[model samples]
Target: MTDFAVSYFGGRVSLRFAKGVPFAIAALVIAVIVVGITSLLAGSYDLAVWDIPALLSGQGDKTALTVLWDLRMPRFVAACLVGGLLAVSGALLQGATRNPLADPSLVGVSQGASFAVVSLIVLWPNVSIWARPIAAFAGGVCAAMLIQWLSAGKRGENSLRFILVGIGVAAIISAGTSALLTYGQINRASSALGWMAGSVHTASWGPCAVLAICAALCLPALIWVVRPLTALRFGSELAIGFGLPVGRAKFGVITLAVAMAAFAVAAAGPIGFVGLLAPQMAQRLTRAGVGAHLILSALGGAVLVSAADLLGRTIAAPIQFPAGLVSAVVGVPIFVLLILKRANSSQL
Candidate 1:
């Protein structure tokens, strides 16, 4: 009713309102509506977006319901689920690692899955589609395990030195992947490039099922580890000071983070930045403080991934880049801002 309040309300939406909870919820609701409409309307054979609700509820025509049930719906669910996982995994990894730069990709999970998948695709040209996800999943697990073993020091003491080891492994695997592509195998390279770029636009429900299963299995495990994760924020000495199981807890969280990251990459093909951006974006949203609130970060991640997918499909029209590419492009600016914030002040 006041002139100042009216002016403030009319001028712009406040993104920082009360840890931005209201806006985040609004953003999520809007994202869901947008994604649902876009998925129903997208592709060469477009359908009326408004008709989707009837189709989903089995009240529509056979053809419309079939299209929604068989193809568009799967792609829609896959995009949101994988996106949510990638983003939340990023948030979890960063919280546990206590490094802004730490991500599944930075820790070697993406490269591991990428290397395994590309190698299998290139070598076993006879392999079936059903086998690819399995191979990628196996590769991801192997990568996480390798990093854990190499990073473990005497008595399992934790240090940034483990990150250094993971970085080295990532670099080595990355170079090897490059070599596979550089051997004048254009078709193999193209496929590998596509996988590395990451997309859920063409995803079938099978890969989504793999990711969803991981979420079902790993999320509760992550929750169980949450208390120790909070303890970790105060540093190992402080954690030990509070009668927490310092070495074991940190190692467990770290392992869970790696597994989640690896499984995500297998499901969606080495998607990056979601892990880094999701938590940072959520932090800006929460402004309440640092650390993971799993469900909120998941929603934020899902929103981000779906928005990026919509942009990827719509912005270029007939040609679309990977959703992962869009996340990287969007995330770079966020990382820069975080760096600048850290330089100017030490709060993050």
Candidate 2:
């Protein structure tokens, strides 16, 4: 294979590794492991770090195994899964739409999912929990289609135009969600609020299984659309001229992305900014090609969510904060800096 090098952040980086592994990717993987291990060990119950391996091997104390295997493990795995899914969803959206601010939450997909779930809970209280993911996926797909239709034009889809329209759609959906809560009984509203707040504190095997199955089903579709998504970054005209079925491919990408986000919302309640932060951070850290960027973005998202959940767990001790709150708290400053940098570089 040939080697490619790029200079980023005033430093020269080389992509000359064997077996197609980049240095940045290796670093991200290591970071994810470190974060995962820390999350496994730093919960409310003080489990000895060394006991984890023994517990996995069926030799640890009953109490330690119960804490590690029963309580913390599910949440840990769910955080990683939800984080990766959200980040990949964001990468696909940003790549397909060429929008710097494209994210599941910001672009109305998450809000749409939230609105659907909230509405279901308020209006159809007897609906099984298993059906919530389907509702969320439907809502997200509708929002994505609406955005596409609203943004279509002779000059092709514009990034800023899509962002503006998505923001409007999100706000409207959010308002509707609020109205549902306002009209519904207090108990149902409170339950819905907790889900919307986005915590993995209640993580259990069922939700984890559902998320894993969704990923298993979506992975092949994601792989199929990668080429078209990469081509799209170069512009729709060139993509169409290159014999790509731009319309069909773009629709497939949007659907795949929205489904992933919707599943994450169903599993973890609309955790915001994993999609936004993960892709940009991955790009800056690696500067590799689109494929590498996608993988790194997924890893980065996993690390961010795991780390944030861990922080929320330990920061207030005995009163855990929702991961969504921590994500917004952390994401807001990074978002501001991104906006400032883009403005200074005239990319905004």
- Report the number of the highest-lDDT candidate: 2
Task: Assess candidate 2 and give its lDDT.
Answer: 0.85
Regions more than 4 Å wrong, model 2: 1-21, 153-155, 340-348
RMSD of 2: 5.4
lDDT of 1 by residue, 69-99 (tens): 7777777777778767776676666666676
- Please give each candidate's TM-score: 0.79, 0.91
The positional error of residue 304 in candidate 1, measured at the CA in angstroms, is 1.4
- In angstroms, how far off is 256's CA in candidate 1? 1.4
Worst 10 residues of 1 by lDDT: 1-10
Per-model CA lDDT versus the true structure: 0.70, 0.85
lDDT of 1 at 47: 78
* Residue-level error in angstroms, candidate 2, position 247: 1.3
Angstrom error at residue 98, model 1: 1.3
Error at 76, model 2, angstroms: 0.7
